[model samples]
Target: MPEIKRQHGKQLFLITNTKQNCAFYRKNKFQQFSHKIHLLNRQPLENWSFVRTLS
Candidate 1:
């Protein structure tokens, strides 16, 4: 029936939307994690250089 088809289409759309949202969130989380790692790496290098300068 046409009504059944409409319902099926709506469900499919919802499923795809959720999938896209999940992928977007995963990418954001990865970027945040990499940024944190970059900051951590830079901090140690900066400190080492500062210590070397002092010595």
Candidate 2:
């Protein structure tokens, strides 16, 4: 796990979805390093890998 940041209860928000965003990190892997992965407002889930969001 990443370095301990803020801890409240059993709930933990450590490094949300690092595996999803590649290149965002210097390293090629996600472990111990803490980071925030942005969620796509829109995504290409069908034939494309691009991210797209719908309102």
Report backbone clashes per prediction: 0, 4
Model 2, 1-55: lDDT tens per residue? Answer: 2222233232222332434453443243323433333446664232112221111
For model 2, which pairs clash? 41-53, 42-52, 42-53, 43-52
User: Per-residue lDDT for 36 in model 2?
Assistant: 35
lDDT for position 24 in model 2: 40
Please identify model 2 stretches exceeding 4 Å from their true place: 1-4, 8-20, 26-55
lDDT of each: 0.28, 0.32
Tell me model 1's lDDT, rounded to 2 decimals: 0.28
Per-model TM values vs. the true structure:
0.22, 0.17
Judge candidate 2 against the unseen true structure and give its global Cα lDDT, from 0 to 1. 0.32
lDDT of 1 by residue, 1-55 (tens): 3564555532211112233454554443321111111256455211110000110
